[model samples]
Target chain A: MTLEITGLKVSLGGRDILRGVDLHLEKGRVHGLAGESGSGKTMTGLAVLGLLPHGARATGRIDLGGRDLLTLPPRELNKVRGGQVAMVFQDPATSLHPMLSVGRQLTEHMRHHLGLGRAEARARAVELLGKVRIPGAEEAYGRFPHQFSGGMRQRIAIAIALACSPRVLIADEPTTALDVTVQAGVLRLLRGLCDELGLAVLLVTHDLGVMSAIADEVSVMKDGLVVETGPRGQVLREPAHAYTRSLLDALPGEPGGPAEPGGKA
Target chain B: MSNTASGKTPLPGRGPEQARARRRGAHPLARFLVRRLLTAVLLAWGITLVTFVLTNLVPGDPVAANLGQRALGDPAIVAQWRAEHGLDKPLWEQYALHLQGLLQGDFGTSQQSHRPVAQDLAEFVPATLELAGAAILVSLVLGVGFGVLAALRRDRLSDHLLRVLSLVGISVPTFWLALVAFYVFFYRLQITPGSGRVDPALGGAPPVTGLQTIDALLAGRWDIFASAAGHLITPTLVLALYTIGLLTRFTRSAVLEVLGQDYVRAARAKGLPGRVILFRYVLRSALVPIITVAGLAFGSLLSGTVLVEAIFAWPGIGQYAYKSATTLDLPAVMGVGLVVGVVYLVINLIVDVLYGVIDPRVRLQ
Candidate 1:
């Protein structure tokens, strides 16, 4: 086990956003978190990193390896973030600072967490950009966020997330803002990188089709509670809960048409 | 749909094409500056024209207003006075002569002061510039500071107090505020210095930069500098009150907006220090709007100090304008109008240039 979240409860402004949630992500595997909007899917991701909104109260254990993340001091938590755990947000456009260059954004945290010098960080950032398949990695480094397309910006965001080579990655709807064709390429890159690095990934999204495509294990959530969790094939093909069944049925084409594996998984 | 936008991605070997495209237009900033200069020239010309026409159109004779009824009764003196000022020429010829003198950097003679309008403005402009400059500096520092504090403590007691103070600053009339400040600080409390630029005993500095504080500094006159700075406090605070209010409200909203951006959250998730996130990510983005509002506030402060200047008895351009307008000093009125117009144009140009520097999107566009 790489990350274990047990009985996590979060409340914001006197309202329960996440009642009680449990999730476990294993090394070298992708755990897909499936839910509709306002169903605590994104809240769980924020909770794990202690990046929840202001005035939010959370009570639970978020264990990474042996340390309970919820109990760590801010100084220790800062080391864990971008070093032990990293995150890629939903919309790449606004996630990256508009005023900063792509290379600056990619290398800043690398220098902060890994103690890499300027030259070392630059070389690693360029390699990461190339690894993410950006067409001209060296030239793209100095360019601003607006200079790149949505798909390319998302790829740069991923490169920044993978900069310090953390053990766990949380990607919240990474492909929701891209075109269908571009989405396939980004999803493939995400899966390939996590597998190559043997990192635990918590992929959060509302789309079941994305869950079918890359997720190794699937967890279905509704109204701040996880309804079902199992292997990808069992959950996507068999969906024990009514909410999960309705979610699977709402997909386009056949009931489980797009989710049906074509010789993989 | 962003389909067309997505198609604009740069591929391999496109660097040279991009460079060539840039070369065709020159540097964006250089081009932008050139455009702004041209606009300023055209606007300055328009201001001179309107000032000349409007001053002439005021239904009063400068000859009668200046030389009085006894001089107007004498045809010879009236004709000589009119001819001396080029009022006897055709309107078109008068305008042509005015433009010709302006091109030669002559602002003509002022009937009220019996001196050249250029010389009169030179003496008066420095005082107003010094006063407004100090006011804007004070307002900007206090306003941005208060604005950020208020935003950080949203809905708290300090925020409410600041909000109320700004509202009072904005709504209170300048003339009344200036009077009350002068009365309380100078008359009642005796803490601040009385009106005018400096004490009569100091006898002013050598007319170097026209700004008394700097001239005093340049001359190494610490006594003169202290006196000049002491005299500046009441009037500067009165003039800065409105602007401080304006900037506080604007900056509060601007900072609040930037604090909510997704990039701020992303910056936090990167494990950056709190100070780093606040300055680099939050305040940097907030600065664009703050700069814009501050520029506008500074412009208004420069031109809008007439009431404060009057109440404080400061020998600035506002007093000159009031005297010139009441006495029908056409040349002087036109000169004041031109200076005010040019100040606004120059400030707007600076703000536009700053926009390109702050946001790269502005530069590329």
Candidate 2:
């Protein structure tokens, strides 16, 4: 397993935001954690990378390749962050630095993580931009995020996430703020890139359509606990927990067909 | 949609740039500047006119004051003096003559001191400038330090400490602070000189520039200047403490506001270190308001140190103006009034120009 989270608990300002939760994932796979708002899905994701804000307390073993992430000090975490793990946020418009050229944002990550020099990083940034299918990638490097369309901004963000070839990519509702057409395009692009790069994606979202389409496994969480977990095929086809059953029934998505090979089971 | 706004346009007076600015709803900083400068000039003139009227309305006979004490009881001497000084003329005639004299560099002699108004200013204005300059520099150092520290330690203990410190600074009376500072540093400790820019025992090169500190610095006499600063420091500190408090609070609030913006939160989420997030995202956005407070405070500092200079026995324009009022030296009082008014207006103009550069929304009226 590339990343394994076990029995995570989180509290903020005297309130329990995340109750005990456990989840596991391996390399070259996408696991979709589905939940409604305030279901503790995002909190669990933040715990894996230790991104919870000031005064928030978390306890659990988040072992990414045998090293407990929560236990590592901040200095050690810096060496792993954007190197072993990277993240893509929901609102690309907010996620991007408006004042900086996208090229600098990419090259900075490349130089920091991959130890690439100035020329090497620039070449890699252009290649990453091309891989994300941003046309005129070289010229686009000079432009700011605001100059680009919302879809393009998300693409640039995806490119930044991929620059380090991280072991784990935690995408927190990467397409939530985007339009439907753009959402589909971004989803497809992420899935294709994950397969091509052999990267593991922890897709944090509530949409089952997205989960079933790209994720090999699905973990349905409620109130910060993973209520049901299985291969996508078995989970979608058979009823196990009542909450999962109701969630699947009430789901707005067209009932998903059989999960692909190596899917949830 | 209209190109080159024509006479038929509703706002016919607006030029093409103004029309475009209105369409975009961008900062009409150029227009704003034009309006502000006009207001500043009118404000200066209003202050000058009021000072002129107030001084003339005083019942004491300035012409009698001009005459020596021996001539005070003699009506013939007062009448002769009034006739000679042009007090017999109409108010308009007096104002026009004074304005003409002001325009032509003929400021008339000080009645009490019998010095040319220009000569009195040349000797006195430099002293005020020095005091104000030192006070402003001290405030800038203290205010910016507290502001940056407060922002860094925002919502923390240090932030609270600095805020309380600034409030205390603002609340204390300047005259009391000046007196206490004098007692501690001069009367008790004897660490610094009591008054004036320098000691008479070691006077430096003659005043080629009229400013003792400048002349001393020019002569490579650091010792004299240093001693002068030691004396000036106490009073400057007294006057600047309040300004520092105001600026620190303003800067802290400005930084806090910018730090709350979504872009700042976004920068943090990107995993960029806190230092980068602060300097790049937070500081840049806080600059506009910080610049504003600093500029206005600078003008206030220039004229606001009157009581401090007076208590410290510093020879400056404030002391000169006060003495002129008591002695009823009309020319001297009017001279200080006109100069201070001009200084305030010029400083405001500079601020407006700076505002335009900072945001490009201000324009000259």
Candidate 3:
């Protein structure tokens, strides 16, 4: 397993938020964590990255390549944050720094993680933007985050996550804040990038439709614990858990078939 | 306060009438200003009423003090003078007179100099403003720099030490700080020219403007302003010290709050380094609150100019107010007080407008 989380416990404001959560993931695979609102889906991702809100308490074993992420010191955790693992957030709109040029934001990681000098970092940033298929990557470098459209910004957010070529990428409701049409595009982009970059993805969202697009393995969570786990195709065809069945029933996918061009599933 | 620029609405559902009502309720900038001005006036009125009453309530007639030994026998003259200044009426009537004079821009005259108080203020206002401007510049540079440092190293000893320093600054008496600054800079170091800007060698300025710095600059006598700046250094340092502490504390806390926000964490997770997360993501949002506090602090510094000016023997409004207050020059005091109050109002108004310029959300609200 590339990433394994076992018996995770999280409490905040004297109330248990996550309880005895266990999960395992293979390399270069996408695992969809499906849950309702306040079902600890987001908190589970945060615990992995050590990004909890104020006054939250966490315990139990979370190992990313045997690093013991939960017990790692802040400095080591910081090293892991943008190096081995990175996260894309729900609201891509607000996830970026507003004032800085795209170039400045994109190059910063290269400098910190790779220890690249300014010239090399800038060159690499433009290359990364090009990989994300951002038109006029050189010009886009000068543009601020606000200049991009919602979908384009998500692409840039994805580009940033790929900068360090991290092994594991945790996306917390990555498409929840986007429009339905844009959500599919982002999911497709994430799926393509995972194959190209050779990385593992932890998809945390309540949207079943989004899960079906990119998720290889699916895990259904209810009340802070995983209730079911199976292959994405099998889970969608025949959900074992009641919550999983309900989640699929709740989502009314596009009337005819999937939205992919030339290949309808 | 902010007003909407983009026509697109964030909220999907609202009837036309309700939206219109929301729009008319008061732009955030306008509301912030209205609240601040109302608060300023209420505080100003209370302070004025207390100061006026307390100064009078102290067992002595200001008119009698004005007349010196001649006050006892010249009852007719005293009554005439009282009626002319509209002081012969009840205490409330006197307040009404003061208010009326204030609204009309007629602050009356200094009884001592027999000079119109408004005219006298105009003569020295420019000079004091120049000095205050210099002090504010110094405070902003030092304060923002220290604040950025403290925030970058949050939870470290430097952050803790800076917080303690700001606490000390807030607690220390302004006048006492001024005294200590003077004794150390003037009495011991003797590096400065000591009091009031310019040497006699500069020959009372070029008279192009009341401000020594400007007059010196206009005449291409950079040397004179340079010397004046030297003299100004110590007092300006003293003037800015407390404000620096205040701004640093506010900025550090504000930046930390922004850093902890989800958006900043997202940026960091994007493989963007700490510098990017801090300067671009965190500090930009943090600036709104920091700028607000900085504006209020700037206004307070303008108001507090009196003590530092007096301590340094600088020719400024505070010194002028003090001279007028000590001599029971009611007209002079009321005039200076009104001007000071208006200055504070204007400063805060500008600050409010700045919010609209910085954040579109604030403008929309």
Clashing pairs in 3: B1-B29, B2-B29, B2-B362, B2-B363, B3-B363, B306-B318
TM-score of only chain B in every candidate structure: 0.93, 0.82, 0.78
The residue-level lDDT of candidate 1 at A197 comes to: 95
True contacts kept of each: 0.44, 0.05, 0.32
The digit string of per-residue lDDT tens for model 2 on B1-365 reads 12111112232122475568668775666557667778987787687677778779989978655667779778888778888778899998988888778778877788878889888998888888878877777787788778978987888999999999899887888788888988888999998688876776787446777667777788888888777767677777888988899878988888877776655654544455667667766775576677678778877776667787777888889889988988889988888888887776776677667765544223412
Comparing only chain A of model 2 with the true chain A, what is the TM-score? 0.93
Name model 3 segments beyond 4 Å from true.
A252-265, B1-249, B270-280, B317-365
lDDT of each: 0.88, 0.77, 0.76
DockQ scores of the candidates: 0.45, 0.09, 0.19
- Each model's TM-score for chain A is 0.97, 0.93, 0.94
Per-prediction TM-score: 0.94, 0.73, 0.64
Could you list the CA RMSD of all candidates, in the order they appear?
Answer: 2.9, 7.9, 9.2
For candidate 1, the TM-score is: 0.94
lDDT string for model 1 (A1-265, tens) is 8999999999999999998999999889999999999999999999988999989999989999899999999999988888889999999989999988899999998998989999999999999998988877898888889887788889889999999999999999998888765787788888999899998999999888888889999999999999999998899888789888888778766665445322112
Q: Which digits, one per residue and each the tens of the lDDT, describe model 2 over residues A108-222?
A: 7577656789999999899998898776788777656755667778888999888888888888988777765556677778888888988889999876666777888888898
lDDT of 3 by residue, A41-155 (tens): 9999989888888679999998988779999987788888878888888887787766566787787777888899999988888998878667668877866666566666777
**Residue by residue across B19-39, what tens digits does model 3's lDDT show?**
664678865456655666687
DockQ rank order: 1, 3, 2
> Which candidate leads in lDDT?
1
Score candidate 3 by TM-score against the native. Answer: 0.64
Best by DockQ: 1
